[model samples]
Target chain A: MSAATTMVGRSIRLSRRNLDTAIMAVVLPVLMMALFVYVFGGAISSVQSYVDYVVPGIVVLCTGYGATSTAMPVADDMKKGVVDRFRSMPISGFSVLTGHVVASVARNALATFAVVLVALLMGFRPTASVGAWALAMGLLLVYVLALSWLAAGFGVIARSVESASLLGFFMLFLPYLSSAFVPVATMPPWLRAVSEHQPITPVIETVRALLTDQPVTSGRPALAWSGGLLVVAFTWATWLFRRISSR
Target chain B: MIVETEGLTKRYGTRTVLNGLDLEVAEGSVLALLGPNGAGKTTTIRVLSTLTRPDGGSARVCGFDVVRQAADVRGVISLTGQYAAVDEEQTGRENLVMIARLHRRTRPAARARASELLERFGLVDAADRRVRTYSGGMRRRLDLAMSLVARPRLLFLDEPTTGLDPVSRTTTWDAIGDLVRDGVTIFLTTQYLEEADRLADRIVVLHNGGVVADGTADALKNSVGGTRLDLTFASREEALRARSAVGGLADGPTLGLPSDGSAAHLHRVLDDLLAARIHVLRVATHRPTLDDVFTTLTAVAA
Candidate 1:
């Protein structure tokens, strides 16, 4: 609908103007990748090449950062009283959330591209065919979409911007406990169970396998987790938005 | 009636905000909901604007129910909240155009409406500037202008001029006056008695989430006892003597009696005091204001 398009345009403009956050979303992940490749790569001998093994993890981390950034703007809108203005109009709550979610996906695309570019400069290489690369990016897109909606839900529940930024903390920290940095089997039994059972580890493993020409053992589970999260998160976010905005 | 509400109520937890209130507003009239803090003025506006639902009773705007036909109510109304709701990062023009577009205006049409409003509100110079750099008054004006982008039949303004400087307040008043000339039905809430006195054709004094007084400004003022003469004597004994001689309510050293505000009435009172050999220290006439009505009503309700 036209209302959704207008809201999307407005949200993108807001994202563009927020230069500090935009820069942080892109630059932080690239710096993290560099740190992992140069400083931590020598100590980890489980992978044939740490750079090749870690790039997929870094990609997922970058999207997590970008997607969680959606919460700040959503919280800002609610605090600013603009959401009341929109709700009083003929505009539906779906259009407003669509705007933020779409903008989050766009921001993730840019951040993901930047992380991949930096990985190549640091001696990282992917052995994937064109179809495999497309599939990997598609899965990353789905994962970002899911996380962004979940962040938007947090935004609606947050009473202030500071509380909303807590989503970023969780997103940034969850990947570290997953298989993104080290193999799940190398961890203690309890830690290994957590890393293998959580959603992020499977997504990172699937992307890593696809890019490295390895056996794709986690593909089905990755799709299942991402798809299930996308459904629950999208439903929760839109429902919360309507409830909060209306009364 | 363009808007009608009967026994409308809302409660947050155990504290009721709107308590079985009833109201009606004819088309093209300015109605001011006058009340102090915690009087539920904002809650009432929120319900009428379709942003909130009442707990017990029903409300209709433009012949559509506020709860069941909320989308239809939204089509005919706009709300400007106590806080300025403009986007700080977007330019003023962009803010206006975005709202216009949300109302289904074409891009060119939205732009034209935005420009026209910017010119009307004297925001042409800063139209393209980001709202972050705008002064408080400029932002308020832009907020009001955005609500007018769709030209709704009814507008709800909750404390529209609450925090503006004097000049900005007057400018906003002028803008609102212009809207009235265009036959727009306005329902505004204000803690400023002067604002309601200056703008409202019908003033409704709300207390404890219900209407305590509703009438024209002059009518409510009159209800709180009209002009009266205050006679202050040198001592409490002289005031008591004057009260017994002239028959007025005595409090300490002063005696207050209802008057028709005539020179002859003052002369007669002075002569009556003189005949009784009571010396009057000061003579002053007090006229009732909307403040008096508000205080009297709320105090009684409390």
Candidate 2:
């Protein structure tokens, strides 16, 4: 087996051993989607049925939650000397971080699917065709890639796992500040402007339009943001990995 | 030489950790880099292992320049840092297998290698237990075992037995000895004098970011001081009497006198004690320890 495959397998096994991570990645996102659609669904004014309106947002939210999942394990590995051990070995340098990223993407993708299942059970349905579904999935994956590598960067610089987790907490609330729960137009002008420009807004808006078969003026900007974020975060993460590992 | 460093220097900001250091290690021999804390033992190891970059000078391991040919250097050497560096969440068997697989071994080959290492390190019984449950010694053994997965020609061990118990230290020593017997060149660092004395074919004393002394353990010890015999008496007065009669240094119930550490010297010392009618409780010959050499050399450098 190749170094990347071996490291990914090892990372997955290591991350699976943490019960808190399992709850955070899989259970908490599904629960949040259910609560939002059931308890808070009727209060929203702009959307006719909040279940259909909020499922895409929840999918984006759960996928973003993978930031913490990626960060915590990487930080733990750093503290535990496993990263140092990997550095001294005669293997591909990218394998260690790549392993954590691939595992995080796999795990968050599963959680995103679970949220979709729960949303479907709550009377939410997508009007888009199979190709649109595939595109939506691709967009969610791009978000995962951007966030996971960014979180891995945070983990690399963090002195402890708690610090890395704290660094990732802002990503969870990003969807809240944007169009995840309520329409940006419903907010005041300033808040709406801020919400529309944020990364999550473009992503949620694009995914929402695709699933609902609505016109997507935001798709180009969303693709640009995701692609750009992936590049910047991947470079930042690789730079940090190189600097620290060489020490 | 399997490893050589020429004026190898590393600095952390304004502080110099390794300053114009030079070292050489022959193949298939155990070379111990002996030093106290903050003496740059670990920095030297890191440079040689390609884990850290040198600010100045150059290092080569297994004939590959550590900076320009790092991948080649890494391909031929394995380093076990001061910490065990094993994954605590994984079982010993799993850790070994993970490393073996990373080294590009086949699945079955990795498994076979892991089992062999587990048995050789006497970790077979605890192979399935998570490393978190293993004792420090067990974790260290597993760490050493993991480093040997690819059977690199040279091994770098930084303070391998720093926190182990006596029995565990001995076991680790035996394990290292076994590796050397198999013709693996070992470069280990330690603050323990006895560790260097017992395992090192040649000891390099690193002090103040430079090599203060380097030679065989016996040569370093002899360079510090000669042998001396300590005669213990039943009473202080008797020891003093024997000291004056034998022309030796006296302190309470013990008299210390220089000797060649030969049987004849011992017999003559006993003969002097008998002539003086001093009752000797015990007699011990003291050869200068690595501690003595280290302290003296570092003191002189200071």
Best by TM-score: 1
Task: Provide TM-scores for the models.
Answer: 0.91, 0.89
What does DockQ give for each predicted structure? 0.72, 0.57
lDDT of each: 0.91, 0.88
> Model 2: which docking level applies?
medium
Residue-level error in angstroms, candidate 2, position A19: 1.6
Interface RMSD of 1: 0.9
- Residues B13-68 of candidate 2 have per-residue lDDT tens digits of 88899989999999999999998899999999988988899999989898899999
Q: In model 1, where do residues sit more than 4 Å from their true spots?
A: B228-283
What is candidate 1's DockQ? 0.72
User: Mind sharing the TM-score for model 2?
Assistant: 0.89
Query: Which candidate has the top score in DockQ?
Result: 1
User: Which window of ten consecutive residues has the lowest lDDT sum in model 1 chain B?
Assistant: B288-297
Residue-wise lDDT of candidate 1 within A1-247, one digit each (tens)? 9999999999999998999888987889899999998999889877569999999999998798789888888998899889899989987856877899899998888888888898899988899999999999999999999999999998888999889989898888899899898888889999999999999988999999999999999999999999899999999999998788767
